[model samples]
Target: MPRADTPGTEAAPGGRLRWWTELPLILLVYACYSAGRLLVRGDVADAVDHGLAILRVEKALHLNAEHPLNRLFTHEPWLGVPADFWYASLHYLVTPLVLVWLFRSRAVRYRAARTWLMTSTFIGLIGFTLLPTCPPRLLDAGHGFVDTMAHYSSWGWWGGEASAPRGLGGMTNQYAAMPSLHVGWALWCGVMLWRFGGTRATRVAGVLYPLVTTIVVMGTANHYFLDAVAGAAAMGAGLLLTPYVLRCARWGRTRAVARFGPAAGAFTRRLTGPGSPVAGPVTGPVAGPVAGPVVGPVVSGGCETSAGERFPRQRDERPRSGAEPDASPADTGDGAPAPAR
Candidate 1:
């Protein structure tokens, strides 16, 4: 069934989608998530201490489920290898693909959905920076926790460190385990699919994807159960904050238009709009005039004729076919087109 836009709002015109417009922002956020360790590398001993504290709390709450799950997964190579693969792959792949799908399909809600995903990611990044905690696999070997990826290193491209690819383990921040982005992102994808998808199978897949992700992360010893809880909390924060974020953006756009008029508003929209081409000459002002008539959207109070020329609104007329369009009247008093009488 075709979905209708909500009552108070309208989908963008021409059914246009701007998947490319937000690519840079997404990449920037990911780069921050990846490199933010430099700003707040928690003390190793302190991180381990936090990990132990988490275990104690989980025990008190009777929520320390990672141990048994990790044991069950590690005992069987059949389970371990695939869980390792899921840990290594899906965290990076599924989120982006779902984002693209939403951008293409859910025109009305895409902005809110994207905002939620980005907000959650930044929240997780802040958690990693402020409260870095070690995962089960990195705990003392005397503990029963097993790093499934390390155990199955030879079977796949990952090394003995985390599931980072061989020779790149150095880049992996093993201590950034408090709020698991894997679970957070998986949950985001699952939520998007469930909310936007129509079919029962799609909804089932949405539910199963996050459920399996939670199990996989714990089974692989990549996150504590509480870490998953924190991830969900971060996602919750994101969901709560997105509407306000969008409201502020809309208010800012309205203020800009009110202050600077429609031209400023149009320029602002182009800059923020999806896949805006304002960066290049195509959307930039035409210099002086072209030898031929320009025939496109008027810019800066002037009309463009088919012959690639620009003139003020007074010259707004179609040129005769196969004829050169007239040039802007020189600013002389007599030659100017008579006032619109």
Candidate 2:
């Protein structure tokens, strides 16, 4: 058997070490979602009205729902379904997965990244509370799209007059549909996972998730093509803002490190000066007593008697810039003083 400290096992302490690393953020995320769902909990009537307005604009011009992307959710199995299970259940898995990636990867910022993920979800939920609208399926009185969620009653959960809920236990939101948060959250999770997941399987999971979620939402009748677009907009905004947030955080960290102080400049000393760690092996301006020809003071040198006291000096015999430059040959000037030859 392999030791506990082996590579895949105990050898490394993952981000799992944090108490919230594996599960707490998930609860917090769901709590925010549940709160949004609560505020918008009511008859599906208003949602239906809002979604119809969207259809009006689409039909007003000759250029609308016939567009496959818009009708992507309007087709047979596509028109009448709900990917709510995919949307809801995925919440449990993606949270932990993000934690594992943060622990493994070096390029990521753990605390700030987590903050962004949760903040984006909260923002989406807020949109839900403020602009609740029913999806395409409930629009049977309006358009011809089907309701996949209602059709697959045995598979997942969805609500409204078209189909009843199993119980309040699984209920999330019945009318919040201006933006499809299922799509937004899925996209957010996919991005962070792809950037930070250590294993190949984990990385691939990131790519496939959003694609699958988009299809599931449309197939289930819980969203229109436009809802997915709106979800994507929210997600894109969050991701774009992440770097600026992280940059501020990193700047704060550097200031903190400065205030906390360093190791008395020992590391700094090793990185510079004549006896530096990199001084000998790598070639550079060989700092010494005498200045070399044209290139200033970069050459080999030796010891010499200066006023009877022995001291190291440059060996170049070029001129009276500092001292004798040559190492082997005895350098001297004219028969005269020759500048103390």
With candidate 2 superimposed using the best TM-score fit, by how many Å does residue 104's alpha carbon deviate from the native? 5.1
Model 2 segments beyond 4 Å from truth?
A: 1-17, 20-26, 42-45, 59-88, 104-108, 156-165, 198-205, 243-341
Clashes (candidate 1): 13
Candidate 2 local lDDT, residue 201: 85
TM-score for model 2?
Answer: 0.55
| All candidates: CA RMSD (Å) | 12.4, 11.8
Q: How do the predictions measure up, each by TM-score? A: 0.72, 0.55
User: RMSD of model 2, in Å?
Assistant: 11.8
Residues 29-73, candidate 1: write the lDDT tens digits: 788867885466788998999999999999999998898989988
Instruction: Give me the candidate number with maximum TM-score.
Output: 1
